[model samples]
Target chain A: MTPASLDLRPLFPAIVVAVTGLAVLLAQAFTPKGGRAPAAALSLAGLAGALVAVVVIAGGRGRGAVLATSVAADDFALFFQALILAIGIVAVLLSTSYLRETATDRGEYYALVLFAIVGMLGLVSALELVAVFVALEIMSVAVYALAGLQRDRPESQEAALKYFITGSFSSAFFLYGVALLYGLTGRTSLALIAQGLRAGGIAPAAAAAGVASAGAATALALVATALLLVGFGFKVASVPFHMWAPDAYEGAPTTVTALMAAGVKAAAFGAFLRVFLQALPSLAAHWQPAVAVLAIVTMIIGNLGALAQSNLKRMLAYSSVAHAGYLMTALVAAPGLGTEAILFYLVTYAAVNLGGFGAFAALTRSGREPVTLSDMAGLSERRPLLAAALTVFLVSLTGVPVSGGFVGKFYLFSAAVRAGYAHLAIIGMLMSVVSAYYYLRVVVAMYMEPPVGEDPWSRVGTGAALALTISTTVVLVLGVYPGPLMAWARAAAGSLR
Target chain B: MALFQAILCYVFGALALGAALVMVAQRNPTYSAFALIVTLVSLSAVFGLFGAPFIAALQIIVYAGAIMVLFLFVLMLLNVRTEVRAPGEGRVFKLVAIGLGALLVGEIGSVLVAARPALAGGFDASARQVARLLFDARYLYVFEATSILILASLVGAIALAKRDPSS
Candidate 1:
């Protein structure tokens, strides 16, 4: 398709999110105080409409380079659009009750959530470097605000400041990397860059021999790749760049934390997969080993960090980091079944992490932090359903059989092994064993330990319960019957090239 | 004409550097802010010397004008007292600052010299050309996305900074 005649039919989901975000903002302005329920209802309706649009578009013929070749409407992008929209719906549901309990239930919260989803949808579809950067910034700015949503909490403010500062630093690096890549290949479009590299149009030797020499150009490209890696690394909360994740996750509202752990990480991985596997596949020999090492380090460090955490939020934060490592292993093995593996893992991971956080949100009441291990003491006695749900989630997180996480991990490790990275898979399995300690620790705290004091069995709002139930159902279904989703994921992965 | 441009570039560049030095040297926040304005204005002048008048104007309007004003207002609102440094502390800071500054200058000088052959031709940075390119399909997405980003930031700022009446 020509750029001039770029079709926008595939952008229906993103357009829905953008319009819904603005409508929510306008509604917020017009709605009276204590009308948070209506605003939330409106947001939910908008997300459901977006979800419908995603399904319809996915059923249509997948295409490439929509909106003037800036974004692709391929199945890969559609998969992420659907995943992010689903996650956004659940997050909004969780937020409705949590915000109400905390007395921060303003319409702006829902509006921001919609805007963040717009960013994610755009990010997954963006085919050009400039568009990627813009979408990245859009997502980052919205999340930064969400991280600091609790105005009265000093920890929240600190979280926002730290995330914003570090996030901006990474953006700068990413921008510089884009500049260097453009200089090397004279193109910003991912497909064109790949074509140029494959055709020897931007040969390293030719670049080295030129005025700046082939060495300089090649060096620039390498530096650019490193910078982009750092940028994506920070977003996915990989080991060395993950210092902000624990604090940010711990400080944000539980619902927001769920969104960060599930939606944001998935979106980041979506971008990472597209950029590294689609655009720079020619340079896989250089990047694959580096990424594999990062995966190993991240897996070990994230699990070890979680083992030392007394707070449940902090432990989950570290757990999210460890999961990022697992996903990265798939990326490192991208030439094989890595792409499909990562997609399956992301779907499972999103469901389990969101469900885990949703359970935590259900237990949280206004004006109190019930996140400590002791705070969870005898949780089974207090709230049997929540405890049971949390148990399921934790079990899934530990990759136990009969859960979605197990299937996801099996796919990822087998993909690595099939790709001749059995060592990585071995390390990954060992780390999964190490992770079980912390995941089961929470279960033990809930089931075996006696109550520290009053059970703190506050009522679970309908919205939160719905979110938790949906997440739990997704986890269980994917675990039991992974056929349909695996087929979709494989198709989506095939469309990437 | 080329000779005149070169002279103008050196003058404005030196002024910018001097202003930056003064900004960092000032102990009082207000004075530091004023020095920052000077640096921004001088940088704009340097941009003008490079034949980017539009960017120069934007530098003044956005950075030296609005941003500096905001900085000054925040400084005044906070009313932070001037910090008193211990004798060796300030000395050590100055020494480290000077060393870093020297290293930065050396790096820049080497890069410029090495890249001189590649910089033989200069591209036009006229407003009309920049506008045409920016409005082209290739860049239009980024431009629109940037607007969305700014809007999101505005919403976030208000959401975080505004006080809750219920609280």
Candidate 2:
């Protein structure tokens, strides 16, 4: 708690992004009417600078327990920070042309994106519960606004309202969980809470709530764990808590939906892993069954829901929910290859979802977004390359061979099986098979069916083309050779305190 | 004295819950805002009974005082009318909401029974100690982070609420 320990280096990544956000706001303000500021480019450069900051300070002093353990810059943190920054880069790239096409290109769009990245970086690195909550709020509030950026659209407004209300409820659940844990252990730091829980020393809590006995402590811990799970479940769009996701995803601008599916989910899973693995490892026996049940229902319900959707965005939203199920299975097998699998799966998932949404965005013609399967008919004959890109992403979502999703699911299910949750692996595999039916339906539409009308697809813009290339390259590279990323994931899993 | 404190806690807790329910059910935006104030004040009183007078005062000063003023100002600025209420969502959605509400009630019930509020002698939650924690301790990082959260929300609110120039 010494003043000397209050170093700012560990926070450079977030600060750099925040400052860039302000710069974006200024750039927007100074631009002449009818002229666009380089808001998207500014966001990309800021993310690049933050990426460099994450690398330069990776092993620096005061990184392990920055600001006396409110946050940490450990390997686990650096890994997610780099991944989140990369996701931000692609999101900005995708938004450049997509936003302009939809006439939603505003400076606040980039600024809010940069701020959300700041939140994601902090969420992954925070060691204390309060810091995590604050970071989560920063991310969610920005995204809620982004969801409704097209003010002229009623659907967009509805999306924003639904997301904000449901998001606030989830945040309350999380805050209550934090309060319960602090009451049970008289601590906020994850490591100290684990220590207190392990020692069976329920410290004298603050004035509001306290546990008087061991039994009471255990009850409180279980309830807190459930509440935390619900909070994260809502964020990741798990089944039963995913009611708002389809509407929000379908209503928002497609590029923003891409960021929601990719960046927001990645940030949630990162904190979800840290909290469960770091603070509640000792209570594994009590919470593991709950997570297992959630994974099962999420996978079953998510894939089935997606099977019923013809709209591309709603289908992807449900598919994202199903992927959350697969990721939670890794949580069931804590502190081992399961941890590594999640980190690795998150990367591939982000790349694929961004690529999928990017391709979906390219369907804009005359400012109208064509989103149905019928609209995608004979896409291979029209925009052959775009159709091919969407095909690969869909194949990846289906867990087909020579795709990143295949490898990621392999590791996830294998880890689940290894942890004696063979039922989880079995259900996961069955669900992936079920998912193929809906995912490939898009492919069949693109390749086999005929276009419904004479309307042609929009040309792929430069920014979107670059983002697609990056995502496609990453997906293919991970599919063919995932050794480097796997090693990084292993090191990160090892560094969890 | 302990009996009196427990009774007061229940009363305030019930008031908070009832007011929250009323806020949700209110069709008028202005009436909903008033109900929210009732809930916030009841919760503040409950906090006072728990010996956390600092937080109790903060609940009133920040939420009931400053934030409520902003809410009312926005309502007035919008010059909103009380629209006719539409029927609820589909039957399934309504059923799900009711089920979730019951579950939430059960959660709160169990939490209340399992973890009771008692005055701990060791902790100092007075304004001075709270300030030191926010200013000088690990919480300094958290306190600073909230500014970023607030700034992001400010920008977000403007983005969402502003009228289009062309319109």
Candidate 3:
């Protein structure tokens, strides 16, 4: 665990991303206009390589910290690395046609995507607070720019501004929390901090014997925990901190929104699980109730907000907030099952949400995006195959039987109930039911409502279609045969505990 | 020596506070920028008094030097000819903001008072010691990651600010 014996093997995936991002940037700078295809291909190759590295490393290693104990290259980190890499690849595929059509097929676009994945990988693996903050900024800054990529759009600019301001504000709170934690425990490493807390309850035994009062140290730790919660809650887009999600999701390009919902949320949850379950286990009595309340509020607000949205993007944004709530419920559950539930739900959610956004990206025309519910009215008649795919995604999101979302939610709620939170689980079930109304509304609009005008569907490219097919297949396969993925999740959960 | 250091700390602290107030109250963007620079410089002096010479140097070099220049450049780029004062709208906002600010200040003050008996005298670390700590294995990863963060921000700025010829 010493710094001098740091192993770089666990960092292979992040290195792949960083190197590819730089290469993409250089290629973009040198390449002629309209030659951005190679950049996309290069980015995809890099992500695929990183995914392979994750699988290989996962097979070869035991669970432990690496890079001088700054990062844990455990099954948890490997799982998130694989998930984020898959998300990046899918997002890149989905972005290809959108970029070409919008005349923004610059190499920098792919570079930013690769770089953001690097951040997410680092974030999931980060074992220290400073590392966590650094990785988070690496992701957030890139994403802020990605959100405002379309410089001509006022909404895009506004989304970037709001996201950046709120994101940085939350980061400040997180850093202050880290400072306070260090003050209390005299350690920056989460493991050491936990040991410090367990040894003397709050402050180190030696420090407690000195001038520092245990009460003040405990109070500082509580404040730090609250600040950390606010920072992370904002990242996962829970209620009260979710005002940016709708606008940011609605304004960004569909592919970027897909990455934000699938990749960013998963990465944040990975960190959330580690910091809470592993580092702050002693303070569960203090944090568990606060998290439960947050989960209930997030679910209610997110679903209710979605109910009022006519814009497909806005609705999905709210749905993302609700999904975060569902994941939070899993976190509030008993430790082992809760961890397993989160991993399983995140995988299914990545598939369902990406597929959902991919369908929208597929329908995007040359000069206009498919924003309104009316845009999907005659989708069934125009592009029946896409409409069918959207139906599967929507159905899965609604937690209907024979879909991945249903199984995921079932496990999440059952785990919560087993943890003796039946009331919270009941509220979760009701919210899921409420969520189905909006999800089904989309299906109903596509299949039942008549066309308002001529077909506005653009030609779906091979890349977009390929991404859709993969995500759809994942959702369906996981739904039907959940055994393998659940086993993987369980194994990953074991490493953390 | 301790008395002199204490006096220096109070002087810099007061100067920093006054500069901050001036920065906030100033209507003209250029004047506000100048006031901010003064505040940063004075804060650096306070840091020096606290025996964190490296941080003080960084505060002056990074915050007062590079960041303030960037701020002034942005203000000039935006070129607000006149300060637009919304009389009624700002009043409520200002009041609420001040109320929150006071509450935060009060909380911090109470916490400091509660921990006053436990407060230990500061031990100064030289710049070399600070460097060693930062470059050590425990922080090396984060330090390296910060470089990548800065790199990402640099790339992002260029990507956003650059105009697309196709557009």
Best by DockQ: 3
In candidate 1, what are the lDDT values of residues B23-139, reduced to their tens digit?
A: 888899899998999899999998888778989999999999999999989888989558456676777797998999899999888867765445324668888889988888767
Docking quality tier of candidate 1?
medium
* Clashing pairs counted in every model: 6, 0, 0
Model 2 clash pairs are: none
TM-score (chain A only) for the predictions, listed in order = 0.96, 0.97, 0.97
True contacts kept of 3: 0.76
lDDT of 2 at A114: 92
lDDT of 1 at B2: 95
Write the candidate numbers in order of decreasing TM-score.
1, 3, 2
Model 2 regions lying over 4 Å from their true place:
A59-65, A206-210, B1-60, B68-126
Report the C-alpha lDDT of model 2 over A1-497, residue by residue, as the tens digit. 67775777668899999999999999989999878888888889999999988888776663464657788888898999999999999988888777767888788999999998899999999989999999999999999999999988898999999999999999999999999898888888999999988878477553245446788788888889899999999999988899999999998888889989998998999999999989998899988999899999999999999999988889998999899999999889877899999999999999999999988786675568868888889989888888888888888888888999899999999999999999999999999999999999899998999877785677888888989999988888899898999999999988884
| Docking class of predicted structure 2 | medium
Provide the overall lDDT of each model, using Cα atoms, as 2-decimal numbers. Answer: 0.85, 0.89, 0.86
Which residue segments of model 3 deviate by more than 4 Å? A1-4, A33-37, A62-65, A201-212, A450-452, B1-39, B42-46, B74-84, B89-124
- Every model's DockQ: 0.51, 0.50, 0.53
Supply the TM-score for candidate 1. Answer: 0.93
DockQ of 1: 0.51
lDDT of 1 by residue, A1-497 (tens): 33566566756787788788888888777767655437787888899999898787777664443677787788899888989999999988887767867777776788788888888988999998889998998899999999999988888888899899999998998899888777778788998877765554464433543524545555666777899999999999998999999999998888888999999999999999999876787778888999999999999999999999998899999999999999888888885489999999898899888888888777667757578888888988888888888898999999998889999999999999988889899999999999999999889999999888765645788988998889888888989999899998999999887
Q: lDDT at A180 for candidate 1? A: 75
